[model samples]
Every structure is written in structure tokens, then in C-alpha cells.
Target chain A: MADKVLIYSRFPKTMMARFAERFELLDTGGKPAQDVFSGNELAGIRALLTAGGSPLGAEAMDRLPKLGAIVCYGTGYDGVDLKAAAARKIAVGHSPGANAASVADIAMTLMLAATRRILIADQYVRSGDWASSRQSPMMRPQAGMPGRRIGVYGMGEIGRKIAARCAAFEAEVGYFSRTKHDLPYQYFPSLEALSDWCSVLMIAVRAGAETQHVVNADILKRLGEDGYVVNISRGSVIDEKALVAALSDKTIAGAGLDVYQEEPHAPDALTVLPNVVLSPHIGGHTLDSHVAMQNCVLANLTAFFAGRPLPHAVKTA
Target chain B: MADKVLIYSRFPKTMMARFAERFELLDTGGKPAQDVFSGNELAGIRALLTAGGSPLGAEAMDRLPKLGAIVCYGTGYDGVDLKAAAARKIAVGHSPGANAASVADIAMTLMLAATRRILIADQYVRSGDWASSRQSPMMRPQAGMPGRRIGVYGMGEIGRKIAARCAAFEAEVGYFSRTKHDLPYQYFPSLEALSDWCSVLMIAVRAGAETQHVVNADILKRLGEDGYVVNISRGSVIDEKALVAALSDKTIAGAGLDVYQEEPHAPDALTVLPNVVLSPHIGGHTLDSHVAMQNCVLANLTAFFAGRPLPHAVKTA
Candidate 1:
């Protein structure tokens, strides 16, 4: 008999196809556990698969009496109640850097798009503005990447990759992280200093309570009128309201965002802004990234069922 | 009295303000020299300024009999009749490599936008599809930059910068140029071989009679179905009809174009395609690049008027 793994989050059927072949999945279809499965079925579940940004608390864990591991599908595990899991002696595992490259690639995409005003240019061409020789203030010349300052907020896998890419464009790179690493980029002690020095600020910090709303009005103000911000990390890292106000008043020139305060829904105010470029939160949603993450998920579940420690387990405080 | 310099192309007043301060400019407002100036004025003209892409054939050069110098405002001087200038002992100068970095940056912007389908994603969000949890075929996972092959067709200043930027993104860089140089990227003997080996073909070759329509139907077929082409050099490098057909029939994945065969007008058939991303040939239209190119133009004109060889003169065949 195959081990039973409860699916605690909503995922595409195709994404769960591989897992279904290996385990007898008790999928809740993103609903409450008791509503989807009987007490006996829930009680027998030994492991659960979840999106790292979906909330999974102690109450949900208590329902699965035999639960031994909580496996997160992506790099971030912010939505998982780590402290609650720790107290229950439940091991937490995640695909640590599996999607880092893809996420970093999106960061670069957003950075280049915002800095170059590509969306506006695309519209200008499509609307026959170019053919008519109509002048648009938005089509004015912009600053290129060379000699521009790019400040990264975190220096983890994604941040490091972003820094390396920016440096290749001849942009001077700097970063602020909790712990400094021996990298080629200049290190800043605080986010404020980094924002003040750089014209483009890239947010790649991990999502946690300590980092929530760290990039607020003051930080946006520090970026000044000719600055830009690119966020590929969690939406919680920035105060969305403040960002809108900053862009509206020209406090900061523009922004390119792949994440939002609310998933599957960005504010109408943000959507209508001419200076901003918005996309659904898809930083790590690449074909290669999904395969790598699935590999990690399989490895973690296999080890847990085999009565062994997870090779990619996350260390909890 | 200041030296007479005929403005051979239309320029914004602001861009010409600096030149006006030092020269006696006879602005033609992009009109024919005969229509805008008297015979005396045209005959006395010893120097002229022109946009690099504007045509200046022998007839036009003959109109200004005393023309000693033809100063091009940008790196490319393809439209100038080099043979005609050389026969007349008229020196030709251009802002060579002055806008290379800016042009390279646009190449990257177009590459990332097309490869990642940024325009589609932006529409998905703004159209409320993302907010409503709607599925889009275009939103499917894409291949990231890391480990992707990028083939540059030229090794000029712009091509070298594009290769370096792509390399920083962790892409495997390759190229094919007229003469091989000592560079870090793998060099191919021909564009056909380079296109076959790489997934993304970056067109950065100099525009000239010898290189017209080199990337034809056969070359597009070599790229196959999962390939992309980004052209920042000139539209004449690729056959527009072949490119439109390839993109429409899915012979190649997509394209990002900054230039078109016809100035200020792209064909409706090409514009209607969803896979391609278009820009209005603003590759070197950055503030810093304009300033740099203007400085080079000033230097060339200053030297020519002083009865010396033009400082930035282009060696003709």
C-alpha cells in the first residue's frame, strides 16, 4: 500500500499528477480537511503537500494525528506555521533554492521592463502613434542600465542572481541583507542606506513577520523622483498603499511588480496607473522550476515515508 | 562669424540647441535642400549634419558643392553614400559606439519581453483575468535565462555589450562575425551554424549592401520552433515577409523588433501577430546616449571646420 499524502492547497491537476502516481492522495481541493475527508481518513494521513504561501496552522495539523512532515512546494514557507509545527515535533521540508534562478530571471524582466518603459512603447506602436508621428511625453528618453545603481534588499539565492545580472549590464550593484556574504557587490548595513544610494531598488528578501511592510512610505520617498522599484518577492515586503501613493505623486518614477498584497487580485488603482507595470505573481512559475521543485517534493515525501529525515529539511528557530 | 552647417534632417529644437550655440545652422526642417535654401546658401555650405538612417545620395551631396564634411548624428552611417563622399574628398564622421550601451540595453529589454511574454501577462492582469482566476494559454511556464543559448550575429561594440549582458544572466553565449576576435564566447563560422546551435538569435550586425536580407527563410527554419529572434540593428537584416510568415505559422517561437524595413510604419500583418513585441526603433534614444552622440558630432564638426581631418571620420572602402 502506498503512503497517504493530504493535499492542503489548491493546485492544478497536472501539477499533482506525478504525486498521485507515487502516493494515495487525499486532496481537499483547498477546502477544510473535515469537509473533504472523514475523521478516520484525515487521522491516517502521514504527510501533507502545501503551497509555501498558503496558511497551514496548528489546528489543521492537529486533525492529522499521524502527520510527521509538512512539505512545502516552493522556496517560501512563510504561510506555514513553523512554530506550531516545531512544538508538535513535525519536520518541515521545502525546495530551498529550486526556483531561485527562475525568480531571479523575473526580477530582471521586471527591472528592464520598468526602466525602459517597454509597455508604453508597445502601446505607442500598436496604437498607430508612431506611424502618425504623434508625440508622447511618455516616449521621452530614459536612463540606461550602464552606470546606474541597483540596490538589492536581500542577498539570498534570488538576490545574488539579480545582483550578478545587474552587474553584467555595467550597473553598480549593492545589497542589504541580515547576514553579509563574501560577494563582489558592495554591502550596505541597512535598507535605507541602500535605497538612498541606488536609483533602482529590487526587493528579494524572504517573507516573515520581521520583514512585513518593511518597504513603506519612507523607503519609497528615499528613492526620490527619478527612481524605480522592482519587487519579485512576497507582496508583504512592501506596503501596497504607500507604493500607489508614491507612484501617483511622482515620489518614485515607476514600479514593476509580479507579486501583490492580495494574490489573484491587484487593486484597480494599481492596475490603472500609467507609470507601473503589473503581472500576476509568477516569479518562480517556469517549466524548469516546476520540475526541479517537484523533484524536491518527491525526495522529501519519500524520505518521510521511509522513516528517515528529510534531506532538504528547513531548520526552525 | 560662425561656420555654416546645414541641418540635413529634422531634429527637435532642444536636441539642436547646443549645436546652434556654436554654429550658423541653416535648418531645412527635413525638407529638400533646394526647397528650403537659396542657391547661394546651398553653394556656400561647407559642412552638414544628418541622421544616420536618412538617405544622402550623390545628388544630395552635389547640391552642397562646398560640403567638406558630413557628420552623422549616430553610430550607424549606412544611409550615407560612402563612395560618393570618398570621390568628392568629403570626409564622413559618425558617433561610433557612442550609443552602443543604450542600444544593447533595448536588445535585452526586447528579448526579455518577448521570451517571457510580458505584454500578455500585463494584459492578463489589467483585463481582470488574473483577478478572476482565469487561465491563459500564454501564461504557461516559460524557459528561464540560465543555461539558455544566445547567439549574437555580429561582434561590433553593440554586439559585444549584448553578449556580455546575456552572459551575466548565465546564458551560454555564442556568435558569428565577419572576422573572429579573441572573446570569451564560442564563435561559429557562419550565421546558419550559430542559429542552429542557439535558441535565441540576436541581430546586431552593421547594416550595409553586403548584409541585406541575410537572415532569410532558410535561416529562420534553422532556428526551428522553440527559438526567438531579437533584432536591434536594422530591419533590412531579415526579410520582413519571411519573418511574418515564420511567426504566423509557428516556424519560430517569436520575435522582438526595434526597427522595421520602412521607417515609422510597420505592416499591419506583422503588427496583428500576438507573439511578437514591437518598438519604434528607439534603440539609441536614451538621454545619456543622445548626449554622448551629440558630443561626438560636435567634435567631428569642430575639427572639420578648423580645416583638419575629422576626429571621428569613417574610413571608406
Candidate 2:
């Protein structure tokens, strides 16, 4: 007799095989085709493996009467109903520090891309107007990494990692957090102070109610001319309207963004700005990081079935 | 009495006045109306303040018989005849480290820009076809810094600086130099070995007889499917045709280039490739670097007139 596993999301086949070898894996593989409560779909399920982006509604939770635990295969558990899980005495676990390296890499990449205008130059050369456009003497020379200041807002794991990478470019690094960590960096008491101190301001905080619109119009004003902003955390951290105004007025230099408030639909104003850089919210979604997240899911499942403490729990809502 | 100072290139108005107050400055300040020597420009010139890019031919050297020293404003002294300077007992001094930091910064900038596709993403958003493009998933996640391998060729000052910065990203840093340096990071004995090891390769060496076509077809093949190449050094260091072949064949992932074999003229094949990132040669030509170069010119001039040792000298051709 083996413990039964319920997978709520489609995962890599490698991980699925590994899970099957360990338990009598009842792979539900994808979103419930009809309703989640279809005949015996959730019966004998001891644990559930889930992910973000897909809605795991209360109705789905109600079907899993035997579900003892739920594991999120990502840092965020936005799709999971934590309140509902607590009501059912389901131990919910989320993967932590699994995607830090990937997210940090993207942040640094965004900063570099936004600052250097890589895509712009490439397009110029490719479009066959290289001779007329580039030969002009008045064109400003490409500025490099050294002597630039980079400010990291929210000095948590991702922010610290980004700060280290920026420092490698010989850029002076500063950061702001709620509590001062005894690190060897110049800590700003506030985000505005950090923005004022840097040419590139990178956001690497969590995306939730607490950090929404932290980088508003006032902060953009302080970032000033010849400054760039990069956001890889969450779109909610910045006021999109403020960012557009600043870029339009040339109050700040530029921006590199990977996340947005509405998501998949960035502001038309931001999209049109010559100085701004944008990417889809694909940070921390690398193949390597995905594997890590899945592994964390497996570990949480194994531990919970053995009556062990959940690896990563959401203490609060 | 002040010694006669020949101002070889245009200078800022304030800088010229400062020089005039310091010495008996000659005003060959604007673009020359005719040949520099034919117009009696060098009749009594004892010291020369030189410009970069334009060549100082044999004719100019012949007329400036009494010229005791040539103070080069930038790094490259290809314009000046070093042998002639040595024969005439005219010491030649140049600014070396002044642009090292700037060049290093540009190299890292190119690397980041190229690898992350910042400009491409920006253009995608701006072109009003963001929805169409979002259907295809991106290659790498955003802001993931750690566990990347970065290889540096020609491990000089700029290369070393780039290595330090890449390390800050928590990348596994490696290098291939003429001789193995006692560096903290791993040193690949050959270019092939380094290419095999690194996902990203940065070229930061001098461009001359010694390092021509160092990154050719063979090395590109070794870099393979997952690898990226960034050239901040001279374009002559890479074989443009071979690079285009690799890129077109999809043998390697992509490239970020700031230099080309032909100025203002890049290969059509490279420009057309979606993976390749291109830029006009402005890596070391930033405002900050230009100001530094001017200051170096001042320093070299001051030193030569005062009979002090030159800080940076071109020892070889």
C-alpha cells in the first residue's frame, strides 16, 4: 500500500517519473477537464502539487477531502486559497529561495540591457541604415558600466543578489529595506534616498499589498535626469502613470521592466518611450529554477506525508 | 619665457584659456583649412597636443623638426610615428588607464544588453505587436544572476575589470590570455577550452597584428548552441564572416557586438540575424571618458613641458 499523490498542474516529465517511483502517484496532470469533483477524481489523495497562474479555487479544494497537504511549485502562492486550506487543516507549503539566482540574473540583465541600449543598436545595424545613422559625429558615445550608481529597493534575497552583480560592473551600489541588515553595503533609510543616490534603480521586493506602488511619482522625481529604473519584482511596486510622466518629461533617463500592474498589457505610454525597456513577467521561470521549484514540491510532499514540518509555510495571509 | 605649445586639436574654450594662462599656447584650434604643415603651422612648435583617430603622416613630422614631445590625448597612438619620435628624441606619452574603466563599463554593458535582449524587447513592446510576440516564450528568465559561466579573452585591464564585475553576478569566471595569469578564477589554457566552459564570452583585448582573428570559426563552433559572444574590443579580433556563419547556422545562441571590422559598415548577415546584438564603435567614447582623455592630454602636456616622466607610454607599435 502506497500514499496517493494529486498533481494540480502540468509538470516536467522528469519530475513526474521521479514522483511516481516514490509513491502511487495519482497524476491529475492538468486542470480538471470537467469539474474537479468528477467521480473519484480527488479520492484517496494524501497530498496536492500546485503552481501559480492557474486558479485553484475553493471548489477544487472542496473535492480533496483526503488531502493532508498542498505544495506550491513556485515562490508565490497567489493561485492557492490559503484561507480555505487552513480551514481544511491542510498544511500548505511554498518553494522558497528556489528562484533567487534566476530572478537576480534577470534583474542584472535588465539593468544592463536598459542602460546600454543593446536592442536599439542591433536594430540600427540590421536595418541597413547603419552608414547614415551611425556615421554622424554628433551621436553620443555608448556609455559603459563603470562609475554608474545602482540602487536596489527591498534588500531581501533577490535584491542582495542583484546588488552583488551590479557591484561587479564597478557600479556603486546602495539599498533600502524596512530593517537594516548588518551587511557591508551603504543602506539607505528609505527608497527615495536610494533612488536619489543611483543612476539605475532596481526593484527586487515581493509582490503583494504591502509593497504596492512603493515607487510612485515622488520617487521618480528624486531619481532625476540620467537615471534608469528596473523592476523585476512585481508591477504593483511602481505607479505606471508616474513612470510614464517622468519618462515623457525627461525627468529620469530610462527604465527596464519585467513585471507590470496589469500584466501582459503594459501601458501604451511606457511601451512608446524610447528610453524605457520592458519584458514579460518571466523572471524566476528558468528551466533550472523550474526544476528546483518542482524538487522543493516533492520534498514538501514527502515530509508532510511522514508527519514532518512543512518546508515553506505561509504564516500569514 | 613660456615655451611655445602647439595645440594640435580642437579644445573646449575654457580649456584653451586655462592652457594659454599656463603656457605660450598656439591656436590651431579649429578644423584645419589646409594641410597642417604646408600652412606654416609648425614653424616654431616645441610641444604637440595630439588628437585620436586621424593619422599624423610623415609630412607633418618632417615640418615639426623642433618638436620635442607628442602628448597623445587618447589610448591609441597609431597616428603618430613612434620610431620617428624616438629618432627625433621626442618622447611620446598617452592616456592608458583613463579609458580602461570606461571601456570595461561598455564591455559589461554590451554583454548584459546582448544576453538579455533588452532593446529587442523594448522594440517589441513599442512596435504595437506585443500580443503577437508574447505567444512565443522567451529563452531565459529575467534577473537570474547566479550559476552563469562567463569567459574573458585577452585578460588585460578591461578584461580583468569585466571579470570582477561578472563575478559579482556570481558567474563562474574564466579567462584565456597569452600567458596564464595567477588569477583567482580558473584560466583555460586555450581559447577552445574557455569557449567550451563558458556560456558567455567577452572579447576585451587590443586590436593589432598579435590578436587578429583570435575568435574564428573553430572557437565559435565550440561555444555551440547555448553560448553567447560579446565583443567590446576591436572588431578585427573576430572573423566577421565566420561569426555570421555560426549565427546563421544557429550553431551558437547569439552575440552582442560594439566593434566591427569595418567602421559604420557591419555585415548584412549579422544585422539580419535576430540573435545578434550590434552597436556602432562608441565603447570608450562616453562624455566621462572624453573628459578624462582631455585631462590626460593636459597631464601629458604638463609633464613633458615640466621634464617629468610620462605616466603612459606606447612601448610597442
**Candidate 2 deviant stretches above 4 angstroms:** A1-70, A78-81, A127-130, A133-147, A301-310, A315-317, B1-73, B78-81, B88-90, B123-134, B137-145, B302-311
The TM-scores of all predictions, comma-separated, are 0.97, 0.82
lDDT value, residue A235 of candidate 2: 77
| Model 1 C-alpha lDDT per residue in residues B1-317, reported as the tens digit of each score | 99989999877667788899999999987889899999998999999999877889999999999999999998888889999999999999999999999999999999999988999999999999987767788888888788899999999999999999999888999999999999999999999999999989999999988889999999999998888999998888889999999999999999999998886889998889999899998899888899999999999999998888888988665
Model 1's CAPRI class? high
Best-performing candidate as measured by TM-score:
1
Model 1 pairs in collision: none
| Candidate 1 accuracy as TM-score | 0.97
User: Best-fitting candidate, measured by DockQ?
Assistant: 1
Please name the candidate that would achieve the greatest lDDT relative to the true structure.
1
The deviation in Å at residue A126 for candidate 2 is 3.6
Proportion of true inter-chain contacts also present in candidate 2? 0.62
The segments of candidate 1 whose C-alpha lies over 4 angstroms from its true place after superposition are A38-40
Q: What is the lDDT of residue A247 in candidate 1?
A: 96
How accurate locally, in lDDT, is each candidate? 0.91, 0.73
